[model samples]
Target: MMTRIKYRFLPFLLVIILFVSTLTAPVSYSVQEPIMPDSEEARKILEDSLSIVEIDHEIERITARQQELEVTQRQLRERITVLEERIDERRDRADAVLRAYYMGERDHLLVMLLSAQSLSGFFRILDFYDMIIQNDQQVLQSYNQQYRELQASRASAERNAAELAQVKDSLLQQRERVLALQQQVDGALNTSGNPEAMRALIHEFTLYWENVGLYEVKRHFQALASAMENLPGFIQGSKNILSTNGKVYTINIHEDDLNGFLRSEDKLFETFAFRFEDGKVIASGESGNLSLLIEGRYSVVDEPQNAIMFEVERLVFNRLELPDTTRRSLQDEFDMNFYPKQLISFLKATEVSSSDQRLIVRMELDL
Candidate 1:
């Protein structure tokens, strides 16, 4: 009976030990973290960031240059003002001399000569009149010289002022470009960093153009269009474009009012207003329009609410023809502007025909 009772107690003791061990044991838990963007997309975003920094550097350089030009202009203006005052003073002196010569000074000399008691006195009086006339002639000559210098200085100042105005215009354009590029980069970071968002953008870009019988080589037009809103009024014209081809192209503005866009990049268009004859595309040097033609074109599609499209059929990345520094900068800009989120603002601002047929843009570059 005692043995049976001990066996029943053992079972109870084992249950109590198990419960104590369970309370003393350590507990652990884990959380799953979301995946970041792929290396390629991250690299692209980094590249855009670097490009923006470089563009900012260029803008700073341009701003410094503009400031220097303004200082020069101010100095020129001050020089002209000083010269004008000198000319006026010299003229007044010359006029006084002329008045003295014309106001019976000769008569006064003759009367003094007649009143002289000795011949030597009369001779001395004649000499004094001659000296006075000589001094007047010298003063007139000096005044004429000063007048000529004043005119030359005025002309120079005017030229300098005109140059300063040009520089000012350029500064404004570059600032706008910087803002547009910055906007594009930010949009890319938000969209490209997300795999789903990027896929959706690619799908929409492809679907819209494919429905209209055009196949885009790449989906970058959205990126370029996104920047247009931050752009100045003139650059806003490069909106609502759909590229069928794969290459990148340059945009040329024919309107004079729109010239600020072209000039913003340092008069790259020169004086020639490049016209795209419906199906042509081209790219030119940043220095001037006539330096070299990389061959590009742009066109407007009237069917989709005046969509302006730029297509580069043959794009040559890192052209050896361009300088090393320029080549790198161009590559940076090309890469930065070719992303999906870039220039989307310009596309959205378009006046589309229907809700289903909203504006689409694709800007692709081989960088």
Candidate 2:
């Protein structure tokens, strides 16, 4: 009879347990269904992103051309300098010869020709005069050639400078275009149907890019990976000033320490970055067209044991907060728990607080 009574009470106990859990669980339930984005908004997002990419490419091209222009300007400056020096030297030489030619035109050459004693002498004087004229013509031609070359170089330098200015203007214009596209992207995302559906789609796209591992993102990870490989290793390395002298030992970990480790540690989280504000963590990551922001808090879990744990307070994807239902579905992938096993052999964390630049964790021996 006692056994039958115990079995009958089992169902009642289970119902009570579930009801209590429902009351205690975090309240993130949305009364309305998540908005579902239709085709128009989706198309706008794609168009804006692609336009931004094209603008970026154009900016790169303009920058390269500017550099080329700068180099050409330098070469032209040197050329102009050499030409000016040569022209000055030629001008001096031509001045003296030109005066002699001018004097011959008046009467000096005619007097010499009239004083010739014989036919052969007269022929020699005439031929000598012709030679003097020819020589003067050659000198004048050379001087003019140098001046023309110098002018051409100066003109080229001016044109190149103008082109560089135009290139800079083009770059600025391209910047405006990119900014416009960004605004369009924001507007489209904001007005899209069903924020939750947008989040789900963003999540999927982020996961896809993470798995595929774009070259730039991979390079970013590789750079950080050489310094820190995992979260534990990163946490352990942050023991710059270990406080082992007292009963309580402490270590300060900054936002970047965790961000670098997380990004370099997992390719999925390669785009994630962390920021600390008012003792809360504002972590964000970008995957393809969507950006993921997770705001969380660290606290000592009270019920089962005093263990340091991070709880996600809000999850936003592409500027839209995921419904509790959506977060519950996706939060596992963003799960983070601090394990300071290597950091402290047996000390237990009692409190976690934040300051201006870092999160300070206070640990005391369990005994």
Top candidate on TM-score is 2
Residue range 305-341, candidate 2, lDDT tens digits: 5556777687655454433333332334333555554
lDDT score, candidate 1, position 157? 73
TM-score of each: 0.38, 0.41
Each candidate's clash count: 21, 3
After superposition on all CA atoms, what RMSD does each candidate show versus the true structure?
25.7, 26.0
Q: Please report, in order, the local distance difference test score of every candidate based on alpha carbons.
A: 0.50, 0.67
Model 1 steric clash total: 21
Instruction: For candidate 1, write residues 237-344 as lDDT tens digits.
Output: 555333334354333233333334444543324532333333443433332111233433344444443344344443322121221223343334443222222333
